[model samples]
Target chain A: MISRRIGAAAAVTALLFASACGGGYDAAGSANATTKVSVTTFGCEIWNTWAISKGVYVKHRLDVELVRSGGGSAAVAAVLSGAADFGYVNGYTAINAYNTGFPIQMVSGANVNALPPAKPAQGVFVGKDSPITSPADLAGKKIAVNEINGINQIVTASWLKANGVEPESVSFVALPFAEQIPAVLSGRVDAAQLGYSLLGNNNDGVRSLADPFASSNKVYIATYVAAKSFVAKGDAAKRFHEAMTETAQQLNDPANKDESFRLLSECQKVPAETLAAQPQNAIEAAVDLAALDRMAQQMVDLKMMQKKPDLEPFVTDFARS
Target chain B: MSDHGAKRSSLAASAQAMGRGVQSLWLLAALLVVWEIAARLAGSLFVPPVSQIFVAFVDTWLSGSPSSLFLSDQFRVDVLPSLARLGLGYGAAAAIGISAGILIGVWRPAGAFFNPLIRLGMSVPVTALLPIAIVLFGITSGMNVFLIALGCLWPILINTYDGVRGLDRTVVTAARSMRLTRRRYFLQVLLPGASPAIFVGMRISIGIALVLMVISELYAATAGLGFYIVSQQRLFRFPELWAAIVLLALLGILFNAIFAVVERVLLRWHRNVRPEGAEGH
Candidate 1:
């Protein structure tokens, strides 16, 4: 009887204790600021991080708070839900959001996929000894994608379609960028959609099954976004907007190249040596109008977009920033 | 006692029941009120009022034809898959956890062998196991189920082990004296005796199962609640995101209520024998 009483009391206490606890982010070693503008972020994509560490946001009179998001979709959600002031996403996500009436306008460019056609930014890789040699071979085999319906899926699908196969013929599993290489090497996933970070970080001798850029010939896949309402906050919006533009400018400036790569190297966990050798260099901040147009048109063709989005309302005229 | 005394006693019991009801719901109600008032005061587009969330819930999930099983097309494709994965994963975890737990608890050698492995498994967070599960099972529904089941297995196993290992020496001797067969002793005495602890583990595992379900679906999901939530968030569908969250919370509450009712039915004997004023409910 006494044991039962104790057990009941313990259970009640546990429940009460749990219920009383509130969820929060215990951010470490961050600057204490008067006002903090939170932006959703991923592990990599360090332009904004570069700007922040360089005191670029502080220069623009804003203290940027990096809120780690799950992925592109989660980032947008955080922005939409008022949990974040800005979100980083791909072009399709921005276009798709605009079309769906949950409008998010671009604040800055994150990175474009398949940039500098000479080297490109992403590839579909197989194990060094895998029999898979091309897109056709990927049929009936699982391919790890960062997101199922995101840019990687669209690019991979376009490549397969161009190679005389249906996109649905290949299975796309959601694997994080970091895990894609290991997953492919283990033979659980036959191929992985690998970005520059994953490629630079890969120690194992994994070979490209298909260069997605070579197969599909695409570019400009990513961007940063904010809710339309937030963007309409006039001067408050313009302050962050200028801050964002300035940050992107510095990120794109060749003068800051070494610092940028070091920051990216630290964030992406790739060697500084590897980053320096990559011909693609750091993601240029300029949003490519032609690339964005191609992406929107392609998404429409793939049925990934509801309608051809009016690109005017969705993007900032910051291409040359 | 006189008739007035009896009437007063009945009134006191009703008041106590009412107080319990109010006490249980107090925190929830307070939170909602705070949320609604703060949202209204702030007038932010991101934090929609709780009332708006409910309205969206109906619009998003309930505004559909029976062809889609009375769920919105998105819910049919997204929410149903998530529920299926959660159910299958949790079911497998409970079965394996109970059976394995009994093995570990009832047999000293099995306990000795599994203890270190269980401790190691428990020490590793469920999210950390996702990469391994993906590598082993690929990104199929099989991988999601594997993660959820593995994530839920530990608490159930540990609780059941404690219950079975702590089985009274007198109870074992009594069963032996009665010459009960192994199966009979297990079904009639062992399981019943261990059920309370098992139920506690089960209650805890349900929460774990739901968390893993979301995390697994967040990656490599073709259609699931997490996918819907993430997609909606990406698209800036604030109301819909909130709606999905509300639905998930309701589902959790409903599942726990169902478990409570089932536990009550199964453990009616335990409740009856439990001392008066010790109605742990």
Candidate 2:
């Protein structure tokens, strides 16, 4: 009788295992599914949060969940690890992810530095009392970036090269945006790459040393990414892309300025007046393929990767112009 | 006849030791095998097989020449800086702990004053003090060292105090009757009596120091095992990240083993403890 019971138990376990493997159910395939997106508090990710607050996702009949990742690398990890269906990551982070065999593709562009006549969205800053007058002085000094070998690091390197300094001469220290200013002020780092919102309205203790992104009129700052598997499975990517594109368009329209800043104020926790005073970077829903290709080459030149991985396959149709 | 018997007994002892070693290590070997099999079957990128991890570890950390102990440039860049900070931090903790412990243990007033404070300090998590440390020390190696020292300090101090307090009353009386100088009493009587407990504290502190070292290096660090691990993880190099993690585990084991040897040598005269190579009771 005991033997019969054990046999029955084993058969039941096999049946359960078979059932677990048989389903092709995906979150994107379900109606009224919540799309979880990983994002950071600053830069391009703020838009994702703003869209949620503005009810743009709801307009597209999508339920969006924004997960606050620490940084671009973390956001990429979240997407890759299935913690989120999509992540907003720095362009270089997405490129590095692709180069290293992570099956992630760009779903949409998040932000790019504005074409000059408008100040770039990011710049390297030094303490007000620092002796570093130019990019040339930064050759041997440590510079803080949100993530070392991230987009800021690459832009800094390219900017350094433009200034006749070898990118290898300077060291990149990884610090959070919150700590970067303090690091600069205390001389822990000689300079730091400060983003738009992080620069704040009253930047008293620090001075802008150089616009690192000024070297390229169209440096892709950040991109929205989804796992290749997720993009392939259903229309969730389609809906998300349309919603984000609409949000971007609305954010860019001068008529929507008051509404955009108000939503952004809620997302960033900064006053709407303060946000209005800050120069905004261009927000594009279409992935900048030419810019990413250039960045891939730059990664190769900087020896960050063995060779530039073809970025074409990684940019999905929804992200295309 | 006696010599022949001695030889036979020695052979049996060696065989027994071999068996014990195998018995102790078999579980680890079995676990590794199981992990390898499970990982291969799963075919997940996150959990690569053990063999791949081993290869990655060697390539990432042991690809240098024989003269340098087969240590790679990456080891010098990452591991050595971490070891420096750890050594400084642990050394500071040991010095401060033993000295302060002696004072607190011997002086009733001081002990009473510090007891509650030490309890409170020990209860507070070290990671929570990270922001304060950063504010006080900036994001330099100084901050890392300060955190490590703080984390390691409590255990060593408490253990040393216990060791001092636990010393035999007879020994204290004897030292007093001999009229030894305060310095002489501390050196000859109090320290030796309290050493075993002090060693216990130091041993516990070593692990804390290592954990703090990793935690500190995770932020604003240009080079260190923690930084290397985070970078590799970000780059999606799972094997390399796993290799760094394995190296950290090995470092932990190596530190404990070194501490064990030191304790054995130092505490050899204390009969209460079991000595290595001692025959059956």
Candidate 3:
């Protein structure tokens, strides 16, 4: 009985091994040759939309694999861990990672242009009916921001400082974008700093107290980054950059604005009408090297990063071509 | 019993009790001292001191708006949603697990048919199924619950099978000789014998359920404790993230303690029934 059981178990194990080997070989031939890039779910809209809308990169003989992650920081970690060949991260995250000794290079710029300019993606919002009207009123009041070292917090802090509000004068709270509206409506917080994608024109219950992008006009929002090790010497890396640059150009074309919005809406699972109506004024697709440098400097000023890291070493000049 | 025997037995029992008390107190003191030293050394980013975490906990509990405790509203939105999902998902897992476990344990044919599938299911990590779950359920509470249930179901089922299969053969034979009805056989023999294993399964499942709960929340949740931690970590609110971790750990310890208490109470009769000098008893 024991021998028979052992034989059965062996058969099961062998079957599993055989199937896995077969699958791996099939997948390797078709998918493994292409470099896989993991973009955060929040940033998926831009990358996926650009990939499908701009047929330039697809025409360049490059196969792109996109993986959805949670946030910019997570995308960097994914690349560092070898889970992804490239990652889509925010300027703040890229600066932080570079300062912390993570060998990463920004290949192309993803959201450098903030167009509508009136309201940026990151903004501090107060309830429409709230008594607190200005940054000074936020003193001793709870203000919701997404994360401590995030671009929103840095911008908010600088704005507060510029307005003569002490950093410690007001309490900062953290909440997700979707919850920010309800949190403010429910009076859980006096104000919330939310992403432009979420707090834009549609939200009626809150008023923009400050716009981060407008406050720091030169700050780059997010970027497409790759690990230095992967891009150091490989045709795969060059192909990736070529694809990314082409996609960026396509995303910026005025003629493709409607198509771009539709693709972004579909890929992000956001409502088409809502995305169409989203304020695209401040959204840019060019890789702004100067803006990136300023963002790095801001992180240094805030002490979130050790120093202002050299952007030249970390950014591949794909636009030069 | 002889007086001399009674005296010796009492002395041994008292010594053992004293030793247990001393050991427990020592353990508690060691843990506190270690926590204080570690908290002091690690600083705010890696580890918040226990004192500050305690204050954060109190603030979260007492504040009318828990979202006010952090720099973002994400924590406020995600915490309740995550907990609600956990409750629903865990409850479903428990119900299905116990019923299936009992059924398979009591019937040889049922156990034989389901054991292989149960083993296979347990080996596959639920995280790997995230994409499939998202595709099937979308990025909603349903996806979270499905993952949690899938993670928690196996341990309970396996424990139930082991509990029933290990029952004393003599007891089953005796019950059969007496011609006890199938219902009576289960109620009086199978279930009682399997109770200990069921509790074991429950204990294991609780932890697994919590992990699954966190993972599901972290990936796509708009709100929950997992989402709160991720968002905070992303934003570099290290103190808030640390506070959330502390709270989660406390919740886990609390859940385990509650389950243990329930087990002890339910198994009180079984405790005395064990043969004297038996290793387990």
Candidate 4:
């Protein structure tokens, strides 16, 4: 009995090893012409998934890989390390990397806040019965932000300061966007800064104190960035640019909302209902360079950056064209 | 002659200790030199010099006065909470693991029931459990502690069980011939026999505990050293990121050193009775 069991186990293990070995090789003579592009994988880095699902990448003849990154920093790091061809980054990160001479450039816009009238894509969400209603009430309250010095923290601080509340009075909690809902629900934090990408139920005993862009004028939040060397002078870069711009138009089009949402759900694993309730970002191809410049200056003013980074070289102005 | 022999041996031991210390220091110095040279050669912003990391560490952690606990706001906010969670989580795991190990190791029924479950639990990757842990425990220090304790429990438990099960025949006979009560047997013979293995398990758990500490913080933490590391990396503060990593490494070393000292003190008899190089042991 023992011998038979061992024999069967050996056979199974050998088969597994053989299959794994076979999976790694491709025939040399096989005519594989697709340009393999690697992009960051985030619910917010929606373009690659949307493009691939809707055959946009196929249309452009690019084999895009959605590389998993923890956040903007990791994504930028991936691009810089040659692990990714293109990666998602925020305005502050792009500006910071540019200043640090990381050879990364804003290839195209990834996401922006909902154009002023509709509530901003992010907000400070407090419990339904929590006493912290206005931003002024946030004084001496614990608010959760995704990263300590990232956009959420800056926005929360700005919101508090704007409302005549001392920024230092509010303690910022560093929680992932997924956990923010639970943190708020469990009362671990007084409020959570819910970014646009984080999927959460609307009726989960949470209400927004204020929409970020409701008061602020700027809208651009994230950018699709890549190393300048990779995109500076190549037909690949041009194809990527056109594919992204067209995909963005299609995603943003009201007629394609259902299809876009479907692709988003399939890719991000977010339910359509939850996504429907969440504040959608204004996805566009052309980055608003002025907004990005203003944000870079804001970081400098906040002492998040030592000095205002020169944004001219970072913005690839003619990439989309 | 015996007195002279003892004194000479003591002197030799002291010299050996000093030589070992110098060897470790030399290795560390060599590593730092290599790191400095590599950073200069690469000229990449990502790979800052070791000196810069040390400077960042001192600036971030060692700037405060002694009266104010000699820890910077960043250290007080981040590292302190992380250490506290690690200590608490490991403490729980140790207490439960030792007891559970004894129970399953001694009693055949408990071992039969729980061995499979323990095997299955250990096989599951921790990343898969993150969301479940968040949902079940909520995103608080409780959740962090629970995750760390869970990940750490297995090695300690399994090692202790093996230690008890593998007790020497002569030792068991001696323990029985002494006519010891159940409590006395457990307190004296069983525990002493298992001390070395328990320590080995504990050493393994400590590493796992540190990893889980960082991972738990990544999910949702207001203030943790791991979070600070991620935050710095995201913000393009490479020197500060390296500083946080160094802090984590120091914490690991500090915890292990403490454990080693405690193990040596507790298991002195085991070492004396059966040294590692001895044939039987």
Candidate 5:
């Protein structure tokens, strides 16, 4: 009986071995093929969400299925595991996955950080009476990020470095956005990096500290990514990119401003009034090489990666166009 | 002739023990070998080789000073915090569980009052109360402790209650006939009688406590095994991530082994009264 069980186990192992050695499966090869896009209900993913709600992909002769994956890391996982044809994820997440030998390639930009005069989407906040008046004061203090090794942390690290503060000096506590304000309020954390959506949630005791993304000249907040193998399949990537560009154009049109925010608020499950009141992000469809390179360099600086790879290869031509 | 017979049995027993050890470990060893071979052959970045994981584990957690007993700085920062929370939470649970259990067992009215509540507490997944815990305790270790203690309370309490309630009636009658004081009755008769069941509950709760510790630490934690795992996963350091997971498993085993030793020591008298494989009285 044991020998028979061993035989079955060996057979299973052999099958796994065979499958492992097989070539990558070609996906989205047919024109007008249904493409599964993993999206998160975040402000950055507004473009992709808008595209889906407005049937922009269908208009561009592409069938798109929007799979609501939670968070950037999950979206990256969805795309990498072939569970989705493409994913809208944090730009840093895509680059990090690529550096770690994943087959991910940036297909198009999702959202960009607003330049100075316009507030960035995210910022560090502290209690009104906090001793930490500026980024320099963050040294030797505990601060909260939504996730460690996430975009929040990376941006905070960048911002800290820009302000002559060593990122390592400040201890980073990982808390979900909902719990961050309470942590800060309760003196459990010295400060917290929070999005503008939660700004209304803060009471009179809260104060905005600094804009982390403001350190970068042009930061692509998020990007749509796909596996290199999937991107290589015919003109499916091109069609998807075209659809995203059209989506951006339509959203950017003044006539569609109210309608865009409504779609975004619906997609994100946030109050439409709150969404409209928030600062607008730069709507970018084409991936900017300089901005992408800057993010890769930041990852390298943060020691998240050994060295930045030549990102030219990981970006689709359609994304650049 | 008797001495010779004892020696022969001892030798046979040692041989049997060795055989059992090999039987238990062979599957694990085989699986490791298969995983190593399959991982190398597959060459997937996600599924790293076992050897790589071991190396990463040592590099990440074991590169420590001789003064710190070879435990890395990372261990103090990550693992020690988790252990502290687990200890506080588990310790609180055990103390409360045993006391409350005894109260419920000794006083039928109290038991009746708390019966439904205990059942409700046990049935609900403590993780579902994470938001409420965070609200009450903020993102501090208090939140983690509260969740862990709550999760571990039920098993220990239920088992102790069962142990106390199921005490032999003759023993209680004998204690009463001896004109024992209330304190003496509890110490000499009730405590020992119900200890076996109490230990059973505690043994079950150690696992529960460890689970709650990890779950609670997964969010709003600066330094913990869960935090380390999440950070490594986010960094896409698969080997390091696997190392943290393996460390967690080792920690669980270590806790179980420690529990076994304590259980053996505490229940030694009980074991002497009732030999292995003997029918229950």
Candidate 6:
């Protein structure tokens, strides 16, 4: 009798637990029953922060879940897998995905080119007292980059090539971003490639070498992309795009710039003043087909992409004013 | 047996062993050759050949500056932070998992209460919890440790529970007959018997802990192996990415070997009971 009672209780407990966890999706769906949009970490922390803070979803009776991914590549993968409705990817990653057969299209622009000319997110740095000034001087010097395949290295490679330096002329080392400044300060590396903010604060003994973006004549980087299937399936994607465009306008407004910077700082855990001082590297919210095509061409030239994709057909016209 | 028959049997056995060994070696050699050729054919972007990767690896690890390809202190700066996190997170998981597992196994009410929770936890993907963990702990070592623990806890807890519950009833009865208290019974009878299961759990959790450690680092980590790999991939440095992956695989093998040695040392008595050829050592 005791065994029977224990068995019955266990069964009941298991059933209850199963129902509770499974019911979570049902409840979430019913609550909004409206559009559900998925975004990545970069979008969540920066682009989506403005919308989330203003209760935009609540106002529209929509649901927006920020899905964190490894990076732009991972975000694209999520959308392709049907795990996310939308993803924010850099132009390079989006083009790479499209070439690889993922039917994704850029819907709207989140931010315009915020990076300074010749400098993308990363810039080569040398100790303020170091004699390594020109790319030629780096021939026998050690250079540090965040990763071998990161924007820092890509810009560094392009910078070296443009300066008539061989790709292997200087030794390249991979180090973490946080450690790059210290490494350069300690004279561990002759030069290091780092983000603007790291060099801005004088956190370590480093100064920017050359801005790669300045040489490239390219300004806009990163964009928000959505799967073609989602864009076609429902009006939910269109609504999400509208909300994003509205949020971008708010971020662009001069009156809200301070608040926008603060939110960005809070989300990124950086000092608001530091972020505000750096050149705004964000693009205005609008998909520029030509800019995207240029990015794709650059990727092809750099051998990151196998072929240049026709991006005009890939961009969704949901935001056509 | 006749001398001829014995000789034939010995020859067959030797041939079988030799065949297996040679096959394994050939498989390994083929994989390396294929990888090298494919990387070379893929050119600089999709894949960087093993030679280029080796050059990059040596350059990154040894050279302090652009010109020289020699070892430097800079490598430690990138490698140590990740190792430190792994150590702390894995250690915490091991301690908590064993303690909780034992408690639940020994106490009926505790087991009933925790069983459902553990099942739910194990089923929920660890990546899904990252956003919440980040919000609560922020982007620090604490967040990585929490995620690692979440991934490692289930296997350890479940294994420990099974280990304790499966303890020999005869041993418990004997301990009780001698008027052994609950504490004494657990330490003297239950723990020793449950050691094998606990070890199994630990082994499973260790692998999971490593994966979680990397995953957490890959996302928001300011430092670590996963951060190293992601940063490299982002920069489109295929060679450096490959090197980091190789290093991670080596680390995983090293951890597993260490755990196996520890398991063998602790469970020496069980060696006699284990069937022939079944003992890992």
Better of 2 and 6 by DockQ: 2
Indicate the TM-score of model 1. Answer: 0.72
- For residues A1-321, write the lDDT of model 6, one tens digit per residue: 999999999999999987765533332233344544666665334667778888775455456788877667777767767777677776666676676556788766665444453235546778888888888888867677754444455556667878888665665665556666666776756788765766645645566776665565553455677778777766666666677777777776789888988988888888888887776565456677776777677666667667787776787776533
Tens-place lDDT per residue, model 2, A1-321, is 999999999999998976664343235645554444433334435566568777888776666666677777677777777888878787888898888777888988868887688865677999888899998898888999877677888888988988889988998888878888877887878999877668653388888876888785577777888889988887777777888799888878889888778866776688988878776788888887888888888778887789988888999977887
| lDDT, candidate 4, B1-281, per-residue tens | 69999999999999999999998799889999999999988987888988888999899888898887788888888888888998898999999999999899999899999989989988987757877877776557888888889888889999999998888879889989989999999998899888789989999999999999998886566669777877777678898888888988998899889987897799878778875688334
- Which parts of model 6 have CA positions greater than 4 angstroms off? A1-33, A55-61, A115-122, A140-142, A170-174, A203-205, A265-271, A319-321, B1-281
Interface RMSD of 2: 1.8
TM-score-wise, the better of 5 and 6 is: 5
Question: Model 1 chain A: which ten-residue window has the lowest total lDDT?
Answer: A22-31
Better of 1 and 2 by lDDT: 2
**lDDT tens digits by residue: candidate 3, A100-135:** 566788766556535353445556788888898888
Put down candidate 5 lDDT per residue, A78-106, tens digits, no spaces.
Answer: 87688887787778988888888888889
Candidate 5 stretches greater than 4 Å from native: A1-27, A32-44, A129-131, A185-188, A201-205, A268-273, B1-13, B275-281
Output the worst ten-in-a-row residue range by lDDT, candidate 6 chain B.
B65-74
The TM-score values for the models, in the order shown, are: 0.72, 0.89, 0.54, 0.80, 0.89, 0.53
lDDT of each: 0.76, 0.83, 0.71, 0.78, 0.84, 0.72
Tell me model 3's lDDT, rounded to 2 decimals.
0.71
Listed models, DockQ each: 0.25, 0.44, 0.09, 0.36, 0.49, 0.09
Q: What is residue A229's positional error in candidate 2, in angstroms?
A: 2.0
Where model 3 places Cα greater than 4 Å from the true spot, the runs are: A1-44, A113-122, A146-148, A169-171, A200-202, A265-276, A281-286, A319-321, B1-275, B278-281
Q: What CAPRI class is candidate 2?
A: acceptable
lDDT at A152, model 2: 81
Which candidate leads in lDDT? 5
lDDT of 5 by residue, B174-259 (tens): 99999999999999999999999998888899888888888887887777988888888888889998999899899989989998
For model 2, the local distance difference test gives 0.83
Candidate 2 to truth, TM: 0.89
- What TM-scores does chain A show, candidate by candidate in order? 0.79, 0.85, 0.80, 0.83, 0.85, 0.78
Q: RMSD for each model, in Å, please?
A: 12.4, 6.0, 13.5, 9.4, 7.9, 14.8
Off by over 4 Å in 2: A1-26, A30-46, B1-11, B178-184, B272-281
